[model samples]
Target: MPNVKPAMRVIYIPILLLFAAFLVIPLGILFIRSFETSEGFNFSNYIAVLSNQELLTSIGNSIKISSLTAVITTVLAFTLAYAVNCTKIYTPLKMAIKTGILLPMLLPTITYGFAIIYSFGNQGFITKLVGRNLVEIYGFNGLLIGYVIYTLPAAFLLINNSFKYIDKKFIIVSKLMGDGTLRSFKNTIVRPLVGTLGGAFVLSFIISFTDFGIPASVGGTYSVVATQLYQVMLGSIPNFNHGAAIAVVMLIPAVFGVLLLNYLEKRNFHYDKFGETELTPHRGRDVGFGIVSGVVLLAMLSVFAVMFVAPFVSSYPYDMTFTFKHLLDTFQSSDLTAVYKNSLFVALLTAVFGTCIAFSAAVLNVRTAVKGKSSLDTIAMMTNTVPGMVLGLSYLLFFNGSSLKGTFAIIVLYSIVHFFTTPYLMAKNALSKMNPTWETTGELLGDSWLKTVYRVLLPNSRSTVIEMFSYYFINAMVTISGIIFLVTAQTSLVSSKIKELQHFGKFNEIFMLSLLIFVTNLAVKLLCEAFQKKSNKQ
Candidate 1:
């Protein structure tokens, strides 16, 4: 309340109201519905969900798979990140490795499931090359692989960013003090990164646990909470109460993830000074890491290569003739074309408006002395812990009888709110790095807070703004969980269509549609990168 500018107060109103209408109220309705029973308000739904052996098993399966996936993904991601940062590799090789690691993010999570099947299924290319089925890809093994592919990029990004803040001088000092290599690495690198590793683990686990698309495609008969929630909510006979109960249960782990991440981050060690020591490569270590990282990158690229090739074949494993029939069919199908267009429209809208809202909120929170800005920040962060399935179902229940139930507008709004946190943080980071005296200088020269943002802040953060826009656009293009329930016939998206195509055993069309999405997102990403490079040069 003290020293809070009136302009800062005005900025909080719209942001808070937006979250209240789209996020808070809908989730509140979901919580209320979970408690409803046939007789009265009670725990019947919870009892039924917990007592059902199959449902409980799905919960257990999710935890088991997610935990295992987290461990494997964290190790691989950390290795890749360590090689990139800590070892000496050719610059092109390093860039290629980073690109390979991130390529998975451009496609939908379900696409990884498809890639796994296309690569390891009975008649898969790899299986054919090896002359046998190396592994079963229809159950736990497939789900784990899919989760690893889908979650590795995000985990690597987090862990890699953590490495940048550690001072290299600690390692040099440890060496000077007669410490061995292993002990030096433990004290300097591993000890400082424990918090980041835990955060990455929790994040990867939540993403794998709540993702419905991957499990739906590759988890044959192996149930998970996400797929179970989909079944209860949209199955032959829809049961809102049961669905709400499942959603409520899903929220437990997500909340725990947020709490656990916060706790770990708070306990992270703070170094007194950031050492300027540069990392020098040891010949043996560098060569060893280069070989290992090269193999990992190639393996990751092979999956996408299989996905790219699958759409061109006449029939996978049955016929080896190359044909564009599947791609033609994907575009020729009227419904599929409309869904693709819908995805484009939704992603475009989400990028433009989501960036504006996120930037404005960032300005209020980071650039001005806003009293209630923390409330807005808290609510925005809470959306991260709320699974997309839960948020989508909550919207379904809360807006059931409303006019916005089956509209594209609802999807756009839901996507914006669902993905608000990352873009907000991007904008905040960009703004925080600028000259803090910009606002004071503007005011002394007669510019208002809003004027300062437009003239001084926005222009300087143009690269970050473009990045935020691209982030929102790409995520909106590939996302299925949050908007799965919200998309209607008129607003069907390509990501949802991929799921439908999977259920009908249309593998060719599935790969074709997924390829379309991948190419589209990749093109956008490259364009953004080019723009950023040009801006930096200028």
Candidate 2:
């Protein structure tokens, strides 16, 4: 027993420590810096952050916009997920609808901003569709619309899967026992998905809260914490202190959202393990409700269609010509190519290293009988609350004099740490699904723990590893806020370059670049799906 305890520490404690260093240590450093003063520790930074009228206004704006988005998106996603899952929609048609809902998520948020501008800007194609423009698609409107697109896939997927897990027999029994359609729906479907609904709302709120791209493009003088962080770092007068203070402020909402999600995940995640229940179709309500839901799904698809097709138009609404010149010029530019290469290299390295760290942490938490696994959990939970911009600032302070400052290595490292939790949770889910008895039997048969991991765990986890890779790659490609500080001119990422062109009002080039990113991410996602199927077959 003595040998076993120490051996578990030997295997698990290193992973726990690494997570703590990467995730927990940086936040502590941020707090320490926030309290630092010329004379001694003080709350001057916090005082300034809290006292500023502009800061107060920005926080208010963020809350108002995020609240609007949460309600609209949740209602829409719930409608779509319910209509398709509960009704007799054709399977292929259902899959296509699901794909369309997810298409926006695969693209970068910057792309959504550009797409919205071209579709609704002053000289936009659809702007003229009305005799005169009734409302402007800037500020709150643009932010809310972009958020719905940005978060649709996740919210839809979450609720859609939740709907699938509910037993349709419950609904059928209710109807046969004289419950009305609306009455039965409320009692059976909505009640069961309440926790998931809350989970989706909080998740959407957090994504919108931390996003830096959409507001930058179409916000049009709209002030929020994300854009405020950008303004602080602008024009060669880097305000690291102010930025860190704002970053710490942003951490409050993100932390609360994460805590809420953790609570809901624990309460509502059981249906998934209980397995999918069979459906009993309703005739009258299914037809009418399904048609209404289909219209909403079509509207969701129309947004993606506009985003994909707008780049091919030669000039805005004026020329209305068609050409591939925009595409040719975007990839043909040597500057853009360098940025693309930098982004690709960093994404590849992040996938490798992020996967390594997440896999290790998951194994340590699940397999090893170590005392400090709670430490790893704490790191992940705290990191999930840390916004990307704050993370960037933290790296600037922590690694400025170390061996990591101002290099491509640091950017890659930042990506790995910035995106650690998603993959960690994903891999943990995959690990938990497998029977722990597999490991026990292997140990009883005299196999070493290491051999059992290689021979048992890795093979069973091939799908998860691929999913982890896609998550890392897509996030790294679209990430703007964290790597923005780390990317030198020599090592510019595509995300930063897109922001550059947008600032210069090169809207055409911006849309083309966004299209390219969407295509590249789509290709990567497809590749991951293929690999998942191959692994399943094996």
Candidate 3:
């Protein structure tokens, strides 16, 4: 039995049970739909999906782009993580770089797509100046580039944490024994990171594969499974059956990837002969690395600045006029105000709901020996690695016939499933940091598990809980691909509106919505930091 006071259970249990139901029942519906037709329990949909050339092409393209993105993001993240954590650099510069790298994570995918178009599209000033199609901000190239920007934050955070676990003495010993920088890097850095890098790569690849917003905005003729799912399911006439079929097809790969990641994580553990400790600074590498890191940081900033400025201009490149008319028109001329309101509503709800569920699950898995907690952990892991498109489509299959479809609750459910993994990890990591004896001590004193959680776990893990909430809110505000099918005309989000504006060649309006989403996310992030500081003091 779950030990606790009845009243406390009344408050928390219903919330978690609702989340659990949402997560499981939707995917169950997808599986059932996939196996059924009017003819009953047939594999024809799977066969049709497999035999379709267009579907195959989309699968191939998604794999290619996701692979390339995984490589570029991992390499860049490794370099940046090493530069900051290992080198003796200026504290301000390091903090600035870390913050800047994270800035892209806060903005919507449409924002990145818009920024790329303004800088590289037909009327692009930079493109025209160079007198070349320097880069096509559409099709394969554009989606690939945008995904790299979109998934960098999670990749950086994971790889940096992995680096922090490595012992510094090993590197120092190797360096003192006449090892060159290259050899030392191979022995010390690459060896430790090999498993972690693979995990990051697979995780990012899954994210890019399932993402829809960037591809929808800049994809042009290039189609991915996510965009295809959106078109078939939600366009002109809804083809629920075809969408369900594709959803099933997409889920196969995601489930396989998640399984593979689990297997890899298990095999990744090699008993660390050397214990964890703080790394000693390497002063010589600092100057060279600082400059290189600065250049990378500058490139990232330039993209953001373009995004920031493009909306303010009346028309980008061609007219060079300035106006808040675009912003004003969002409320006056467009249905943007509703979309803005809906996006914020979903974000706030997702943040609160997701954080509660993730924290409870983490507590169950880490702080208590609850039955089936391992399964809960595994389910959370599986969903985290599952592509957003798969989950969204699954929900469509599961809920379209139910009262949940075409509702705000659906969007909240999608956000929770789509972004569950990171927050779970965040919460578990927070719980892990607390001394195990705290709970044991409480048990000896006859305090219930619920009481211990109330007095100790929640208070100590406040910063991490807030971090998870902020992450959920920021990603939900920007996410498009995962919840695309779930969103109705009534629930159109700012991100979807940005995509709509882009399709109609409403560049200025697109920029305006993108800017609004970005600014709102930034404001929320600042608020999270303020709360974190206050919590630390208390």
Identify the leading candidate in terms of TM-score.
1
Query: lDDT per residue, candidate 3, 1-538, as tens digits?
Result: 2343454445445645764676667777777776776788888777877798898898889888988999998888888898888888888989987899888887777677767777777776557666877776789888877888887878898898888777777788897899998999888888878878887787788788878878877788898888777887778996666677787777666677766766777645453576755556657788888988898887666666666666677776756688777777876964888898999999999999989888887887777654455766666766775677777777777676889889998899789877888899889988988888787788789887778888989999999999999999998998877676678789999887776777588877777777778789999999999999999999
Off by over 4 Å in 2: 1-14, 129-134, 262-284, 304-307, 444-446
For each candidate in the order shown, give its overall lDDT on alpha carbons.
Answer: 0.88, 0.78, 0.79
lDDT of 1 by residue, 119-226 (tens): 998878788888999899998999998898889899999999988888888887898999998999889889999999998899999999999888878899999999
Instruction: Write the residue-wise lDDT of candidate 2 on 1-538 in tens digits.
Output: 0124445666576666665665567767877877776768887878887898897898899988987888888888898888777777667667777777877766668777777776677765456665565457888888887888888788898899788678777777798899987899987788889889998899788888888888987787788878887777664687667667778888889878877887876666334334444566657867776676677777555555555556677766666688788778877888877777787888888888888778878877877666667676777776677778888878877776777777888888788877888899988888888887876788789877778778989889999999999999888888887777677788888888888887688877776676777788899999999999999999
Candidate 3 accuracy as lDDT: 0.79
Question: Considering TM-score, which of the candidate structures 1 and 2 is the better prediction for this target?
Answer: 1
Ranking by lDDT: 1, 3, 2
> Candidate 3: misplaced stretches above 4 Å?
1-20, 128-132, 266-284, 331-334, 437-449
Where does candidate 3 have its weakest 10-residue lDDT segment? Answer: 1-10
True lDDT of residue 329, candidate 2: 85
